[model samples]
Target: MLRNAASLSVTVTALVLSAACSDDGREASASASQPTGVSTAPATDATGGTTDAAPTSSGTATSEPTTATSATATASTDDPVAPKFDIGGKDLGASTTGEGDGCKKVDFLFVIDNSASMEDNQAALIASFPGFIDAIKTTLSEVTDYHIMVVDSDADGRCEQPCVMDNDYQEFCSPKNFHACNANLTECDTTRGAGVIHPVGLYSSNKKCQVFGGNRYMLPEDPDLLATFACVAQVGTAGHPSERPMNGMQAAVSEALNAPDGCNAGFLRDDAILVITILTDDPHYEDEGTPAEWKASVVAAKNGDETAVVIAGLIPKPDLGCAGNGMTQGAHWQEFVDSWGDHGISGSICEPDYAPFFQQAVAVIDETCDNFNPPG
Candidate 1:
């Protein structure tokens, strides 16, 4: 059973702290074509905060219980001013990472919360992932480079950490239409148009990929990220959260910026404008517990290269408690809107279908970034 969840408020408090951290990796762009974001605010005291950590389980790997200490950005950083948005105002006081315009390439990493409650959600997510890539594919018809990192809270720390890579050290798509999968991976069924993936998802069990035969599992069919599955079930434990999200966010944006070998990954160009799309059911709190966490995630994502963040909150839009409990699970997304730095999109999953929720968000983001190709 869910460990005696922290008392409702206590649980919310714990979840909140994990979202806020003092790690700032900020940078500024030399041109208006680049984007920048920062992660430095103040260290948070995760003490007494609730643990959304998934419980330990006998899985493919040893679960590495993360500790949420008062951490700092301790990395080469950037500091850019925020960007424009449709809804919220920009937090003039908030920090950012980089600056620039558009990007030609994009290395997207989708980090999902796969706790028990997310089981069905995860399936839906997996089913829908290829769609996002497909739409992106339409815009990048000439480019075929991409990568994915799917994180599930429950991972065997020793064998496969929660944030382990599916295609680490390798690129995806093809050189010719390479945006689907690298030339090496052909098992993928790209017939429906999702396109094959290169460098494919890697499983911790096969580090060198000798056993599974890199080509055997690296294909791109219907958004298969099973490589990161075993550990996706180890969340909701009793300790603390993690700090890698901030780091991962940076990596994704970096890929979007410089792309491969100083060249854009294939979309537009390494220096092409960057746009970020975030979908979460929870809040990015700003309290001592969560503000830092959310900021860190944002910083990693922006890295200032002319990035635009579009947040889609799974929770329906409410008139009140935006700064408190209701939003704690879905933190600073509102801050982004308020700052006019990021557009905040919301919907009620209470309805039978979440498509409208997703569509509305996609629409808002499309309008803001001026880049969107709805599934035809």
Candidate 2:
């Protein structure tokens, strides 16, 4: 159960009395008569005017006729209010201790949309990743083993047409040929749901990416994690315009892809907590299957243990002013994220800086890691 801080309100009432001087300049007696009993009826003042008795803190009426000089009411709320820690908010919660005896290995899968108009969003994600991983390392100190993989939303390989690879293994497309190609071009259909080691599509880096142990994913032992991630995560903008992020994510962790000779082999571990982060400006309408089914596939990858999975996304949230550039609201993605309850978090993809969003995600991930029970 999610815990929320309670709000407190205080009310203070002060009474003041004035003492008048006599004609002889001697100070008059400043003592005021006290009420003998609690008043249930209206009390009449010296001027014959009836005034309603004031209620004390205990909700009982007092017969005192004293004047109320001032009344102050103050209301204070805790730092993280109920809405702050809500399902899809930017401020989820504070950092957790992560001291529970749970799964210590974490697997992170990034499903990034490589469609047009995603250059800035991809750049923001890459720029914010270093700090995000650092915070994770500090907060989840026990988690020393990690597997990070990046995959594009295009499973059909729409950019393969009108584009060809040069002798140097560089992708050369019409009007953009002779330019630097940083992607690793492969059989179009083979990239379906495969971990992107060298992104080979339009708007890509056009450079080959080398991972430690020649694996498709990144491990903790990989030297210069930031540099390697920057290379592989630059899945350029020349993908299928109809983004299918859900399909990509589902296939990335599917049993076929994680087999011994599969593309994403050894990426998913039974004793590790799974964290899937989706970055896209498009909705999930282009993807196959419903949000419930997508979630089931992910949970199934973790041996049908839903508690061991966490989902976060930076998508178009119209309510949060995150809709623009032909980016409609992400109702399907929102439902998917909401399905995870506290283990899910969604942020506005239009946010100029993604640092805060990733920072807030750490709190949700930390809580999920605390209670994660690996399947024996």
Candidate 3:
């Protein structure tokens, strides 16, 4: 009797497994009609399965209600509210056009360290400049007055110097004299001679443009923009080993604003916006007082109006990834950036691509301005 009972139990278990494995679909369909204590979501009928069929009193499948799958909507980054402008940290605010005279004046001062290590980075900046101009013209729109200038960070203001290869006194001298001098001399006035290339903002007045045989205005629409930018930006790969970009910038601006009928005359205006971009790989001292004092001078240069000036830094970031074998973040420069608050933006100089940084500068300028519209 016990053996018979055991054999019967085995047979029952086999029959249950066979029913569960069967593909008839009636069991699944019937289960759908019943509900357990736990709440569950409705199921949709799949292909090869019965469509919303219910279990009848006889346990046969019957027609039941069905639910259609609902489509979900996703937000796209192309939306108007999507963030568009970014520096290293936060997204810049969107720009709006306001009521004003049609003319919008923009002055750009680029203070670049022309040290031996800057050749490759300078090339990268020039390569990425077209995009920067386009971002200002196309994105910012109708800038009536736009002027650009370049200044070297060689701040020693030396006269004739020794060969840059021999001594490190390449300070404030032009790179064009590196071949003539046997040893780089510290006291030579670099602010003179071939090394002190004229600012591009004063292209018409700059004799170097004539020397280079370039046309009158090297504007964005000019055909010889590459040659023009190359000439102005080719400040040489032999500048002071301890470059002071802020000092160089101060000297450049001072020459432009102070000189009687200066070379950079008419470039800066009370109504126009002023922009300064400093590019370097290594940190240097702030010679003219603290960063705050220098910032005050920049603001004062723009008629004591902070709104008219914007300063951008494209130097080594405050990070291990940005500094290199012989370079580090410009600590005083970072302080200057902090002084400007929203009026300033920064990017990493170590980056091989400069388009993003250039674009960010334009965007920050746009945000700083009350309105983006140019004159009618």
Candidate 4:
């Protein structure tokens, strides 16, 4: 099921500080409540398999700024050519706008949990992704530049083991032994926080997925976006049992990983609107820091413009009876999503189809792009 926080009773008052950047002159607020009258229904998947459908919910909340200060732009006396905005104490010149006031570039980050219980979730994400991107391309027609990257929850990339032994007794790790293993022993796997182009664990294809450039992430010019994305997004189910999505997200956009020589170099852009989508059934109890601190890390990465980031996720919502089997409620994840107000979207991981949630997220992403004032 899909629920937007705006439908709830929470009121968020945003103070738009700049007139030049506030074309819509609107503020966004949202909060979530447990849905009532819940009932279980069998939902069929693309493969004809049946799964439980989430409870019916209202439409998604409209995207808007929360209590946080919106981005502002001021005329620069030093340079007469363009205006400058102070982002995280650094003055960045404004980029030339398109036909209307909207961001020309967008960066999409997908954080996927690769634990033992994520096989179905990963397949669902891979199956639903083409339509999601197609919707974005159609709805946000002006956005021609894009950077899409995927990262797994574990930073170590080691596989869980009791290694599988061959006829000669040589041991190795594979998807067959993913559930049978108890300790992390296989070291040759995809690195966490780095954009995945070559996944090597559990159910991974274990082949290098090529993009337009030799970069780790996918660009708009990639020859086969669907195929490449599917290859890397299938991170498999051999990651550390204790998932750390927040840490992976923070590290993915951190300066260390975005550096010229880093594994995820050139994935993040200062002038682009950032949209992060996390897919996981784990509660992430092992992840460090509070929701506020995690939000701060992302905002800081985006030059401190909270409005430039959009957080969306398919997580366990136990309160609504939408959590997967053996999955606890993701309290921290829920709080993190709520902290973004309208910019945040949370969906139940138990849903039979993730397409609807992703489709709803497009509206929020479009609004964010419309209001984004890119740094020059």
Regions more than 4 Å wrong, model 2: 1-100, 161-184, 187-189, 324-328
Candidate 3: tens digits of C-alpha lDDT, residues 113-193: 765456545666676665466556654565645767677776432223332432333332323343324333222124521
Whichever of 2 and 4 has more lDDT, that candidate is: 2
TM-scores, in order shown? 0.38, 0.69, 0.60, 0.68
Write candidate 2's Cα lDDT for 1-376 as tens digits: 1222122111111122223222122233323322111111112212112222211111111222332111111232553221121122222353344444666799999999877556656776787687578767766767899999999897644445334554212432322453333234555224678988766555566566888877789998888898999988988765666788999999999999899988898999999999999987653368889888998999899888887888877765544333332332466776677677656666655543455566557766777787777666
The global C-alpha lDDT for each of the candidates, from Candidate 1 onward, is: 0.27, 0.61, 0.47, 0.61
Clashes of each: 114, 6, 18, 1
Tens digits of lDDT, candidate 1, 1-376: 0111112110000001112111111111111111111111112222212223211110011011221011111212232221112111221221122222222334343434322123233344433333344434443333344333332222221112122233322221111232222223222221111111222122111111221213211223314344333222112111012212222233334444334432113322232223333323333342233434544545444553323444443321222211112323332433332232334433321122233233333333333334422112
Query: Lowest summed-lDDT stretch of 10 residues in model 1?
Result: 8-17
Clashing pairs in 2: 181-206, 182-205, 182-206, 182-207, 183-206, 183-207
The TM-score obtained by model 4 is: 0.68
Q: Arrange candidates, best TM-score first.
A: 2, 4, 3, 1
List runs of model 3 lying over 4 Å from the truth.
Answer: 1-93, 97-103, 155-189, 192-223, 255-257, 324-329, 372-376
For model 2, what is the error of residue 72's alpha carbon versus the real structure, in angstroms, after optimal superposition?
Answer: 31
Cα lDDT for residue 153, candidate 3: 73
Regarding lDDT, does 1 or 2 come out ahead?
2
Score residue 47 of candidate 3 by CA lDDT.
17
Residue-level lDDT tens digits of model 4 in 1-376:
0112221211111111111100011111212322212111112111111223232221121122222222233455665443332222321112223333588899999999876556656776886677578767765778899999999998644433344454211211344433324333222234568887656555665556776688878988887888999988987665666789888998889888899888888889999999999877664367888777888989998999998988887776655444332323466676677777667776766453455466557767877787788876
